[model samples]
Target: MDAFTTAWAGLTGWIFETLVQPAFYALGLMDWAEDAYDWLDFGLYGLLTIAIVYLVCRPLEAWRPVEPVADRRAIRTDMVYTFLARLGVLPLLAFVLLASLQTRWEGWLTEEGLLPPTLEEIFPPLRAAPLLAFLVYVVVLDFGEYWRHRAQHGLRWWWALHAIHHAQRQMTFWTDDRNHILDDVLAALWFGGIALLIGVPPGQFPFILLVLRLAESMSHANVRLSYGRLGERLVVSPRFHRLHHGELSAGAAGKNYAVLLPVWDWIFGTADWNRDAYPRTGAPGTEEAMATGGWVRQQWAGFRRVALALAGRG
Candidate 1:
């Protein structure tokens, strides 16, 4: 592990100095170098996530697809969303926009002598067991995600943006990232805020993302696979999440809101444990543009829906 960490750091340093540093120098933006370097690591991790998700889920999809590939165009649109997200377009935007707010918030807390304690600080035994602590962080973050997902469905205006995600009739592994840009930003804020409050380590954050991303992509896979009865309750499966995307499960009628773990759904009464069901996906009343339009068109339609919903005309 130490060797791998050293090699990884070497690679990141080499790439930054070889490419990013020169670009910063030429653009007279050395002030932003530190943040850009951090984002470069995120970008590289995003690439690894995309590769691992595709290599694992794509084969399962081909082997046991619940639905055939009837809408290539729709799948292509989802691929665009995946690339935009996994290539760091969305993360970079969130980082740039949130960095100032985070700095100010941290500064204020420091001035007040109220800087928060990490989970490790609260539970000192966690310091002696890194792997266990990582699991705890995963559980906490997944719990936050479950509630955030419920809000996306329960709140009308948020649902307006979130409907784009449910509008995909041809959901695939790529469909995991098929969210409205505004919804993505809001999600980043919600998730990042919780991470900040709990003091997740910067090194562990990307791995947490990787673990969740792989699970989410697999959950959205077209493949019809489920962890058997006992296993299904432990980890979410494609069978479980596909039902969440079922046509009739849109908006306030949804279930299975857990992102990585199914325990939250089971505990909160949102789980559907039918291992035999793999219902057709898509939101019933969503605009056609949201369901089948190009990326920009879908974004526009989602934005318009939010506008109308906020105006009480949706």
Candidate 2:
């Protein structure tokens, strides 16, 4: 296994040993019920994240009012695509399960024993360094994610899974999660792999995941949460991220692909934030063409189209 995988396993073990176990004991829960409680906690939080994303996007109607595409049917079609995309979550769950198994079987390395160190043991200076380390860790993790995202676009085969994400005709918070099953699995692998390689303790992964998810939801939100010029310089805002979803105008479609930081886009020359002109949303083809064949057929058609182009038959 890679260093990231090793560290992630160690960290997860540390988290359960430290925070989760203590919490279970304090709550007087049955020893056997701890795992169930953890699952419940994660599920509840996931639903809450979805609800928050919806709430944030609902208000965008009034803020930066643009002419609705006058295509309710297309919107409905996109929603269906989004629903089908939820099936992608299954592969993500599988990756999580696999990672857990791998880590447990391999066991953790420590100074004195084969077992992973406890959270306190791993980070003895938590009182002085927790916040600082966390901030640095978050930035590093975001940077890794940014590069992984760029690779998905630049690499031809990877784009197949990613194109499902871009299939959305509308850009909203929910659009953030509209990825293919393969895409989701690859993403988890990247994120989890990187975290483990860096030796991030298990206790920290949950909190990090929480923060990243919230930030991702906020980035895709349709609400007018422009961070002004200064805020845009520091972190990604809705305005900045929306440009990534903007349709190609005069051959400028693949710009602004950064996830958490606009700095990467700016540095890499992909940033295209034009506040002066409102962008047109949706993919290249018309909704009617996309919807005629139904979801499965449409996906097959898209794949075929790409294949033909690759074979120089288009």
Candidate 3:
């Protein structure tokens, strides 16, 4: 593990210096070097996650696919989403927009003598065991995600935005990131706010993202697999999450709201233990265009739906 860590650091540093740093330097943005470096690492890790998910899930799908590839085009659209997200295109924009606002917010808070509280400050023992502290943060963040997911399903306007993700009947690993851009923004704000509140260390963010995203992708995979009854309770399995995306689970009627841990769903009475079932995916009563439309069409549809819903005409 030590050797692997050293090698990974060396490679990440080399790539950032050779490619990312030089571009920033040339553009007179060296003042933002530190943040850019982190973004670079985020992109690299995201790409690597995509590769790893593909390596692991693709074979499983081929071997024991629940359904055949009847809609290659739909899967291809999801691939576009994976690239847009895992490549950090949208995140880069969000970072730029959020960074200034965050700076101002923190500055104003500092002026008012009310600095944000960190988990470490609240629980000093966590500072001594960084790993345990990180795990604690992970649990807290996952808890936030579980509720955010419930809100996505519970709130009518939010459901209009999130319906894009559930509209994919041909679910695959790529489907995990196939959300409406507005939905993604809302999600980003939701979690980003929680992270700031708890003062999640910037250093620990990428690793947390990688772990959560990998589990999420795996949960969406088309593979006919489970982690056994007990194991399924510990971590979300494909069967566990597929039920959340199943036809009957659409809108406020959803279940299995956990992302990484099933405990949330279990606690909230949202978990369905019918592990043997893998029902057909996609939102019932949604337009067919939402299920198989191109990226632009789907995003536009989500926005339009939200607008109509908000206007009391949906």
- The top-ranked prediction according to TM-score is 1
Top candidate, metric lDDT = 1
Which digits, one per residue and each the tens of the lDDT, describe model 3 over residues 1-314?
67967887898899989988999999999999998888877887888889888888899899998888898999999999999988889878777777776788789999999997899999999989888888898899999999999999999989998888999999998899999998888887888888778877766655666667778899999988889979999999999999999999999999999999999999989999898999999998778878999999998899899999899877
lDDT (C-alpha) at residue 10 in model 1: 96
TM-score of 3: 0.94
lDDT of 2 by residue, 14-76 (tens): 766677777777888756355544554455446545565456555764466444545455455
Q: Name the runs in model 2 displaced over 4 angstroms.
A: 1-36, 67-92, 104-127, 201-214, 223-225, 249-253, 285-314
Per-residue lDDT for 215 in model 2? 71
RMSD to the hidden true structure, all candidates = 1.7, 9.1, 1.8
- How big is the positional error of residue 120 in model 2, measured in Å on the Cα after superposition? 10
What's model 2's overall lDDT?
A: 0.60
The sequence of per-residue lDDT tens digits that candidate 1 reaches over residues 95-171 is 77677767888899999989867999999999998877888988998899999999999999999999999999999
lDDT value for model 1: 0.91
Model 2 C-alpha RMSD vs. true structure (Å) is 9.1
